[model samples]
Target: MNDTAHALGASRTLWELAERRAALTPDRPVLLQGDRSLSFGELRERAERVAAGLYGMGVRPGTVVAWQLPTRIETALLSFALVRLGAVQSPVIPFYRDHEVGFALRESRAEFFAVPGTWRGFDFAAMARRLGAKGVFEAYDGEGLPDGDPAVLPPPPAEGTSVRWIYWTSGTTSDPKGVLHTDRSLIAGGSCLAHALHLSPDDVGSIAFPYAHIGGPDYTVMLLLYGFPAVMFEQFALPDALEEYRRHGVTVAGGSTAFYSMFLAEQRRRPGGKLIPTLRLLAGGGAPKPPELYHSVVREMGVQLTHGYGMTEVPMITMGSPDDSAENLASTEGRPPEGMEIRIVDGEVRLRGEAVCQGYLDPAQTEEAFDENGFLVTGDLGRLTADGHLVLTGRLKDVIIRKGENISAKEIEDLLHRHPAVQDVAVIGLPDEERGERVCAVAEQAPGTAALTLAAVTAYLRAEGLSVHKLPEQLEVVDALPRNDTLRKVLKYKLRERYSGTVK
Candidate 1:
């Protein structure tokens, strides 16, 4: 392993690092959204202009700039611009409705906001206007921002200087908590991930995940930090993604496990159509990988599939590296990065690392997140194998205890996803009269496939050696599952709202 300590001893602030990289690789393509392409030099120049514009609007160091924009080159540039001006950025997912957006803006206490006039079939300018009228946010126009010379801007004063980014977690049981990350942490996590994925300047990354999420920001930072080219897609349509991959020769692409499943489905429909020949890695997160989906990608798409495990609190905790065995990729979230530590207490996963977030925006939540020993109690149930691989069971809070028997919803869901007819599944604990709680499986079947019944699914589970108690008591087949932007996470609470009464 390369000595991270020696390599990062002279690390600079986020902006300084980006600027130094831009100077080193001036003519390299930094971002590509559709036909638009910006070289590193061009990207740096645009970021400086945007920084000057923010400065003109009285956005100084430590000012919070809330942005609700789609995945675009402008969003990437403006984010870097905020870092250059020493202002913190809070990027809300573009799909967030008014209530969610209003809450995040109020919670973060942002002074300025940036969004595209319109993007990807949505009118963000209209959304901004509505938010402005309600006094929800102070909006700025990114399209009209002027360009300035990047060399004129001063570097950040010191390393570890605060450059905050507030991202909300998809709270399953409670309101979303704002996870506050520093520039140092973001850069460190992104650097480690870039190395693990073996990304290079020549690699073109297709980013379909929302920029409001951690994966989006991580990819953007990786591209900038390593001088890699990125093709930003506003949405994750499989056809559009395939076209982009072919057009850009994209090598590294990733999002949720569901996205990969959908991509494979599309690939099956279009036989003999291979667009991404240079594609080397397909990274997934936000949920466990279905064994079927993993095999499909390896057999059909001809790419290495990697699963990443982490939350907004401690982003990039574990990842299935590019060099990992296929069995490791299918079973574990690979190993922790060089300087990270992971342990299991009782059944909950805990982590301590430089990449971990400082704390929540709310002190009370922060206090609840960390135990007395200062390790961030991840609230995730996982165990480490003797060889040091991390096997995630499920969320500690989401485990289903039926008559004193603990059942992992993830285990059931993984088995369900392997069923030939099952496209996706989410297992949740529903209230029970006798047992404390029973498992209910909500599934979405593959298109054109016959409808699946609970009995059939149970038969498959039985054949797979699942105990009778572990099988879901009830199954609800649906057209689609509610998912976050990444499509990997199923909003179980939503399922609870709709199907809790159906559990036996």
Candidate 2:
């Protein structure tokens, strides 16, 4: 649509785009949570009211406001309100407890903290008080969301490059780092995802992950640009939520690799039938997708599974298109958008683009992250193919050095995913005196399947023509891999801690 391009090309700030889209499609559905839907027109009107109320609470331009809320319509409303007022917004994942929450509030020096009073049986207000959070208020249950006349609202933000979003890293390995983002950067990221998917106004999408995640805005901007609707799941669970997916006739569905695995598992329960009849594509990013999983989905689920590469710093870096070759979709993380620049320096993926974040909240960390050429050091070990598709090997720190030889965890994990008995697996390096580090594979067995052993795994890898040294030397089976609350990415650091023997 020409309007979509105009919004992507011309709008400087998110509020401007929201307003422009609202003018174009006032009554079109945008954010849908079950029976409740917020049209573009309502987004502008309600955000203005919320912004006015926040201003009444002394939340002036440049004010820092922090909120820890779940994936819900109210959360989006609060975030857009901050954008409307040009205030810096730091959204914490609802699952983060006081330890991370306190650090974010104190580090950001936030003027206010918003929380759900008693969401998921936890009293966030009590934690806010315990942490001595400033300007604490309940933002849900229709009790205390900022409310006032839209007539009192100030003009919406015009600048897009200013730092307005603060998203924290998952913090699996260390203290979470605060990554700063902007409207233009987020818009650029969202545009890449939208165009790559080739969505239409009649198409319907769904959100299966947390709304506070960076992907939230990335998906929201897609709706605004393309004039489509997406179902928002407050709490996503399989079979239970499958009814909703079918009810909405969702055309595109997926959160990440974990989400794809979850869908595949459900499909396996009842094979030879479409999980959602209307579903045509499964698209997502934020975690690695195994090649076998792609083949299985296309072969069984009867839908295209296009994965991509994205991080909190840059919500969307590259995205797999539906029209790409099966081999390309299975092996690569798609190609970068027109503005994105990807470089592989010593196997570390480096990026420089408008979609990239400004930097971290700490100046020193920011300085350390960017190279002299202003490229953001992604820390991810990867290489660009001849056609420019990114193929990530593993994290630079995640490489296991075994007797002076580096073992890529991703390569092993991808191979292991093909094994029938292995439901999900994580390859971690455990310390050993002789080998320096030993390759270990921890796996979750498929339902009703026999247990997998180290010998069997090694033999399978060997049969598949894997290097002898690259085959896992140790194997451990678990009920489930230790994963973070959001996106359910395997926490290999936790695995290392669990498997780390008493040695250097």
Candidate 3:
């Protein structure tokens, strides 16, 4: 391996450090999924077996291997195994249907696939086989596969050699885009995240987010780099997660607003209840977190609530550090971590840093995403505070122009979420003949709560002293809000699809 300091610019790649840690803590638990646990040595052995298996299958360096598996021990092992073999991984959420899976496969040009036969009552093998026939690689069965002899592969030629992963965007906006990340970028991002969270070898991180997302992968890499143990949960159930946190002594965890809400609901169900005491930090991102949820997490759980703002193209651009003020933690996505630069132009957020992805796989997209100056123009609309923190206003495309006023949909949605009966809310702009465009709010009411009328919503906005133009002219109550895998982010584009022209 290259010099640890040089490979990471100042540190080592997570896999590189993991090998050293495995030798140091061979019998220590490195991964836990349900009742099954794998020690560091066992995990390394299994990864070597998987690497040998891939070698036997004729997979070589630079090959793309797509994986769609739950957050199981094998999933973690296989992911590292692909890295050990110098292959790039493209992880897709297990919940992705055929259409989504096919889109990712096509975008990444994946040549090999790894999937579970069955997980959480779903038949992934059958589902995968059907999709594999359409062009993707055939799914390999992890359970019945033989453990081949251990074999070591050459390390990457050098830092930033070639692409290490092709991570797909969350697709909350339009079609999913593939973002290429080199080993240098991945190591930098992981180190930044680990430093931001103040993670150490004794820390045990419990991840509720899907492994397919950037947040999950970054968290995993951070923990492994620090030689910390991580607890992976396949499904997101608040009570079960709480039990796991308490059982595993999990120190750090992260999820979306929906997860915090579920955890809050569970806490209310018990007498004088609270989240596990071992949880030192609770982080939420991928969407705007309600102030009430933030307050509750800090008040009830005795843990700080933090939020991060980033995209797949630039993961962990800004996050609230553990030392940040409570108001900073609650009000904005804290300043950029070390070795990163962020700026605001015409209300659009732009980024430039070592942690930024190389570029999109599509040449056109790569050209479009970055400007001539090489700064990535994030489609997000936000402003940098005087203190350098980022306050997200709304998405640039989601801006509502009614008459002549530019209305921020996120501002209105944040107001609506504060309503007593509103459990979740999303704001979008719909076509309007006279006004140019009108503001619309789609909300999901709390359980057993009565539906809200447009007039009532308008009255609430007026009572809160919001400007007339900021009030949503139209409101729709639905059983549930359409969200991406994290369940924290609202798919406003989908809302636009359903109600863009239907609004009166």
Candidate 4:
């Protein structure tokens, strides 16, 4: 870690870190979107003003605010403003719809809700109203954001260990669990990421994913720690977003395995040419990276590809450093930073660290998530290398990660069961080179019903309000889904083994 950053990392809260960074690098750009930029100084100053504006609206410390906005500069500002007020924040991914969003709002009991109005033809404001959300407000642009004098703002939070964040992650079943976190935990996570990447102020980063995701604060903390700027993409589609990346001279980029594949696909379009002339490193987590994909990025794109392992519970646990060996970089998920302990108990990965979340929102869920040793029981199955790198084998949870987003198998299965043509269904994640994992639905047709097609299944899921990303990419009709003779439970592993490479 940089000596200056290490010293700044000792700050008690995210607001303190932002204030410290602003004091040191007031003029330095911290966030870039299109032709506009927010400097470290401006981030603190504007956030305070926004905080005062929020306070005038009855928001106060400990208020639960839920925001489902895109990856935009205004979104970052709104989030930091909430942090400034010491309010508990719950950010929902923009891709999530009525099912997930409604559940998040209801579970979080958010006192205030922020949306992007009619974003990309979707009426999020209307959806919020439909969900009967409290204090619904549109936060689409700077002009629409509430503004007031910073002088009216209260003192920034001094304590950092109090749980102030609620991040949602798909669980073993249909409902998403709210993973609790504190400011200190998030700081530790960002420090691990910033230190592992060994980023300098000269480096420019890019955030292509939804800022509402856990990676939002994770990435923002890196900027505050390193005093660097990152380009924000609200609607990140390939080829179109590339121009902005090149325009900003992004040196570090990559959101997940899917992002890597997208960049590689663009690079292949112009063989023997640099995808982004200034690009030097590709780094991300939240999805699996095939070893071959790593080698391909290094060989073809001429950039260092360092993958990591993280989740909503612990934003960053292990991350591959740029100085690591190619073999280690290609295979392992990298090494944990100081204070992060990784234990493999009974072939399952358990974590004990400052970055680990406090617990889930539900008390019983919290009790069940931790062990006697107090280590967070990560459902992932992995082992540590002799040298400290982590190599994940598989996951014990019934969740599919397609393009870095988790899709609950039971959620989709429950919806699929409603289809009249489906008698029984088993949803399994099949390995894919590009997406890391593809959602594949295998079904046994209902009596007197014909075989189901992927089109019909997807259409049904869409009508059921399932997100676009969770729709099954492949559909298979079998005489019977492989089930155990003991309790007649669907054998998902057998399905995975049978169809691992069978689907395209």
Candidate 5:
């Protein structure tokens, strides 16, 4: 990393980092997808123009703007424009539909909503209108963004302490919590990722996940800090995206354990040759990486597999370094960065640092989310090794993370309870080869009710406005649900153990 790169953490806001990087190498490639490559210079200039456009559309500093778009240059540009204008941004994953989208707009009280207008066969604008989203506008196409002159734009934010990001965390509860993040927090999180990965200006990266994800800014900040380019995959799938990765000579890739497995599967199909010859490391986090999966990635793909542990609240808590021992990398979630303080309180991980979010948007949730010591309760079960490595054993929260997306068990359970065939239901995450965890719905059926099929349950969930990713892959009907002797709360661990050996 260069001197300016090292100073990114000290920078007040994201716009400052963008300016610093552009000053260092204006013409250098920063974001690439297909034939389009956005340079640092273009990123700055175009974002300012977009900012002006937004200003013309009535966007101003501290305006709450919600955007739901795919991984594209326009999305990043619009995001940076919001940063330049010091507007609070709430990025909704493109895959989210009316249920999640509606909840976000109403909760955040977003002044404006940006949608991709019928992207991938879904009518986002229509959905936005149905949800009564205010100031709804298309942002996918170049023509959709509001237009104005840069001279009309206000001065960029000088501080990063105020909350400028509202990231949704699908927790154990039915409703998703809005995680509050500042520019400094995001920069700190990104710095941890960039420095730990030891990425150089020459290393080419890829964003297989949605740019709206918390990892988007986490990874984008790395590109700005190190002055490297990353290929953006609007829609990522093996063999389909492999050509682009090979064409770009992507050196670093991987989104989560599922991503590593996908690459390994692709490698196994062609055993003799390298999948991507330029590939050197596969690093990611968001879900628990199986020990066997890591071994397979390293052995089969011939690339180092390093995983970490993080949530929406704290984007990058620990990251695996290229210099770490293979055993350590495979077993542990690596170590926390310099300023990150990770404390294991009664086996649950607690964190305190600049990278951690300010708290949830709900004051009650915020107060309950952190301990009196000011440490954010991660609700994840972990322990620190003698070598300072983080060993994540399990989670205290009843949330299922499949393919890097957090699915609330309680959310599905609450909705499933309304089903006519079910009396009681417990949603559990079962191990799967493709998705890290396949959502399994175990239900105690009503007496005399017919057996429920997986398809029927998923269709029912779809009708209930659940996201496709959160649909239950496996359905197991039981006569009764196991509950403890105390208050009769269903024990999910028992269900996981019982269903581990079975398939859908």
Candidate 6:
């Protein structure tokens, strides 16, 4: 990172950092969406107005506000507005329905909730009302967002150590855990990413994932630090979304391993033609990346692909730098940034850093999440190379990562056990070339019950209020699930080994 960016990164709060960046490059565009663009100056000024408006709506400093909006310029505006107000903001993914959404609102004790009204044909406002969410309001566009005079707003948050953000992660639990984070932690996480990628002011980036995700603040911090603009894709789909990428000259893109696979598939369709003429690098994290996929992307897509290690608890633990050797870049998850301590204890990855989150909403879970040494005990099993690169071998937790999102196997298993056709159930993640890992349910039929098909299993889970993204994509009926001799626990590894090859 350059001296200027490193100095700008020292700002105490996210709002302070935005103010500093806006002062430096007020006219430069910070966010691009289709034909629209938001300048750095406008981001600061308009967000203050929105903050004042939120003040008029009874939102005060320390007030808990939750928003479930898509990836759009307006979403960023509203988020920053909350930052300006020093409100404790909880972001719920738009893909989550009543189950996850309700859990977040209730756990966070959100005083105000912002929905997209009817987004992507789903009635979010109606659902919020149905869930009895407090202070429900619609804020999909700039016009819909609250606006008032900045004079009414109090001073922006001066401290970044206070927990101001609550991010949801399934982790190894059946229900989502609210991960606590502060502005300083998020800024530190983004700094690790921005510095590792070595982005320049000229580099155009794109966000193809949900803005409600922890990656939202992670990416926005990078933009603020580097003074670059990233295209905001409300709905990212190949072929259809290619035009905007080309229009904005997106130089850096890729949300996860799935995104790389999707781009590779598009490039394969055209053989020698470039997928995006200006594209240069594809970087992301959250899910496993196959070594072969890395080689394929560099050889076929004509771009540098760098994967990293991150989660809601620690947004950027390790990130592959563009300057690293191709071999290291392909095989390892890259090295941790300064101040991020990666310790391998009992073959599991434990992290302690400024970027690491404070803890979870549940006090007991928080107490159990960390070790005596104060390191966050990540359930991921990994090793450190002699050169400091991280090589993740497997996860100790029974969680399935599909397209960068964590899906709890036990959550699905518990729900599936309720099905009349399921006698025993074990949910495992199978290797998928496109999705990094695909959710597969291995089940045994109940006595005097019919066989369960994949379609039937998905429908049953969906009806049970499980998020669409968490539904199993494959199903296999067996006479019995493999169990260990000692505890009679279901051996999920055996199921994974048996079905790993079924996908690819």
lDDT of 5 by residue, 434-489 (tens): 88889999987755677788888999999999999899988888877775321133
lDDT of each: 0.77, 0.89, 0.75, 0.88, 0.86, 0.89
Q: For model 2, what is the error of residue 294's alpha carbon versus the real structure, in angstroms, after optimal superposition?
A: 0.4
Lowest lDDT sum, 10 consecutive residues, model 2, at 1-10
lDDT of 6 by residue, 1-504 (tens): 999899988989999999999999999999999779999999999999999999999999999999999999989999999999999999988888898888899999999999999988999999998999999989977589999999998889889999999999842226889999999999999999999999999999998888988899999999999999999999878889999999989999998876786798789788968899999999998776767678879999899999999999999999999999999998899999999999999888999999999999999999999999999999988899999999987677666888999887756765775686775677888889899888898988866777688988898999999999998888888987775221133567778778888952
> Given candidate 6, what's the lDDT at residue 253?
98
The better-scoring model by lDDT among 3 and 6 is 6
Model 3, position 197: C-alpha lDDT score: 70
Every candidate's CA RMSD: 2.7, 1.5, 3.2, 11.0, 11.1, 11.1
Instruction: Show the colliding residue pairs in model 1.
Output: none
Sort by lDDT, top down from the best: 2, 6, 4, 5, 1, 3
Model 4 C-alpha lDDT per residue in residues 1-504, reported as the tens digit of each score: 789989988989999999999999999999999889999999988888889889999899999999988888889889999999999999988878899899999999999999999988999998988899999888877587888987887888889999999998843235889999999999999999999999999999998887877888999999988999999988777899989988999999998876786798688788978999999999998865667678878999999999999988999999999999999998889999999999999988999999999999999999999999999998887889899999986667677889999777756876776687875677899999999999999988876776699999999999989999999999889997764221123567788989997855
Better of 1 and 4 by TM-score: 1
Q: Any runs in candidate 1 off by more than 4 Å, and if so which?
A: 1-10, 118-142, 146-157, 161-163, 273-275
Which lDDT value does model 4 have at 102? 90
Query: What is the clash tally of candidate 5?
Result: 0
Candidate 5 vs candidate 6: the lDDT winner is 6
Top-scoring candidate (TM-score): 2
| Lowest lDDT 10-residue stretch of candidate 4 | 482-491
Q: What would the per-residue lDDT of candidate 1 be over residues 1-504, giving only the tens digit for each residue?
A: 234322432356667666676787889997787787988887777788878766766777788888887777777777888877888888887877666777777788878776655666777667666666222222333345545554555555365546478888876666678898887788667766775776666678877888768876676667766677888887778675677778888888778787788778777887785647788788867777766678888888888888888778877888888788888888888888777888799988898887889889999999998888889998889899887889998888689999999999988988887787988889998888899898888888888887899889999999999999998888888889987665457788899888776735
Candidate 3's residue-wise lDDT over 335-416, tens digit each?
A: 7876788878888988899888999889999999998788999889888888888888877887899999999887887778
Pairs with steric clashes in candidate 2: none
What's the CA error at residue 32 for candidate 5, in Å?
0.6
Taking all chains together, the TM-score of candidate 5 against the true structure is 0.81
